[model samples]
Target: MSGVYLIGAGATPVAEHYGRSLADLASEATRAAFAGLPEFAAHRVGALYVANALGDRLAAQGHLGAYLSAAVGLRGVPAVRVEAAGASGGVAIQQAVQAIAAGAAEIVAVLGAEKVTDQLDDAVEAALALASDAETEALHGLTLTAQWAMLMRRYMHEHGYGPEAFAPFPVNAHANAAKNPLALYRFPINADKYRKAALVASPLNMLDCSSVADGAACVVLASERVAREVAAEGVPLVRLAGVAVATDTPALALRADPLDLAAARASAHIALGRAHLGLSDVDVFELTDPHGIAAALALEAMGYYEPGAAPRHAADGAITPTGRTPIATAGGYKARGDVAGASGVYQIVELLRQLRGEAGPTQVDGARVALAQCLGGVGATAATCVLVAER
Candidate 1:
């Protein structure tokens, strides 16, 4: 298989862009990506892949791959849309890597875009609920917040934790976001504020949840041969060392152990093994953080910490950029803002920034290897990727 390298990446500020359409947001992000590679030509893109979760329902837009292709001035390229709930962006990049590895494409552009905040609150909630099992979870009146709350409740009950134990995740995320200009929430929070926040669901407060926002992120991938050419032109390269996707039962109730997050575990195991690296070798992690409990569960599932110990790790500040694992280096979905499908791509972009030593105050010193994981529908689906900075 041909090696795939990320040549350039970009993202719009994670904020409500009520004036921009989804296609417009996508085009802007694409333009930003191309700007990083002055030697690369946009017209030379061989394929385009778009990842989005609710463009159809939120903006009445569909056929995003072709639409974004044309909007970005890469008309007539073979294009397709990929959707796997929140994992759409990571899966789209996986597909692009596969295409390059199969010798089917020399250069590809991956865009993850969403226009969620334009809709009413109830409408946005309904659109997000589609990611869950409609018949068993959504139709039965299980909102995403409620499901996460249940997970938090179970974690607390089983581990003897309190709501305050999970506060560090959001607190740390907000502190990191204060240094990230592209993040939506720029202010830092304290444990007291988190405890006083209003409850969205039992055991889950407003601060514990990621807010839905409008944003887009893009990355350009190329075959090894093309990557060498770009590198010769002075562009730094980041190799896609490993990529994998895994799935589990969609209904949370059907799983034998709801806290296992089996899909995340499997995907991370496969991805890390493919890279010939272990969790200890990773310099940074960009895991899903749509909810505080979700972040803790992902940490445990990814082997960063033992099960039921992630909350304690969080409280110890072990996941901050200066700590042992250094997760969510760009504020993650929590404080950086959750753009649903766009989040996975945003994570990749943040990783690329960290690898390039461009993360400003949030930069992980001497970061060389990074892992990014995106989950869909409460771990029903997961996509994991390992990246190594080219020396």
Candidate 2:
């Protein structure tokens, strides 16, 4: 709130784009962010942060931060790459906040991109490994979907929720994604289709799982002085009220309460306390849904509802953009394809657009307080950020 701030953001589709690589897509998104920020040129950027999910798997892209920096013509700037499973983007944002908080850089650019479609099956297996407890979870043949199935099944058994109870989240997300030009899955979905789709892991059908795709998103942060001097009213400038990242026990089975997300609880609590607000004060909420259970449990753990009632709220049309409390108006990872590191950045980008009144038809009317959550692995690591619109 005192120094570092977001000045601009960008999100681009990742499906098929003239045969561009993941690095290429990231560079393009970075350029788009810079283009969006007509106030600051490339040379003004002092540091670069690139959030990536599959840099090592695809093309062995190990040093993508430097690769992207040179590609954007901002060579020689200190570059750092962040990989926090799905929370990579949130981690990237946190890194920029620290750099600015420590007075290391005044202007920073953060980008998140994933080239997933290139190897779908391998990616799924590898992504599951991130959650694998070498001595426990993975050794027992537990995959992400398998763990999610157990969590979803447990929630249903304990709360009387069923597969049909969670349909509205993807349904509403698809409805909103239809309006977002950058979303990969723009087509609207229906309950019947979702119900009929083949089940991958019980209680989770094809529609229940987000599609595999590619995409990139970017954000530019400038110091408070630069933010006030750079732009006029139309451009969105949300103050980074607070950011908190925390970790919990790695093994999900040994967790005090499988349904109780300690990471999310700690992260959101710190963020809200730092921002001097509470859950009810937030106008918008964007929680990560690497799997459907993630959103349900996160909503419950973050005090939105008791553990048993989240699914009911979701099915009752409570989390849609048009609902009483709008959530993931851009479809989130549930409907919008999850681009790993880019997923959190996309959430921040959509929230920023909503705050600026630039989210075409999906805009939330008078959004002021926004919160974003990104969870890593099967809830082992999580990050939360709170953004407030400044007058």
Q: What lDDT does each candidate get? A: 0.90, 0.79
lDDT score at residue 95, model 1, on the 0-100 scale: 93
Residues 16-56 of candidate 1: C-alpha lDDT, one tens digit per residue: 89888887888899999989785555767889989998889
lDDT of 2 by residue, 221-318 (tens): 88887787765645657888888898887678889888788999989999888888898888888888756677888988888888788777877778
TM-score for predicted model 1 compared with the true structure? 0.98
- The predictions' CA RMSDs to the true structure, in order, are 1.0, 1.8
Off by over 4 Å in 1: none
Candidate 2 clash figure, as a count: 1
Worst 10 residues of 2 by lDDT: 123-132
Worst 10 residues of 1 by lDDT: 36-45
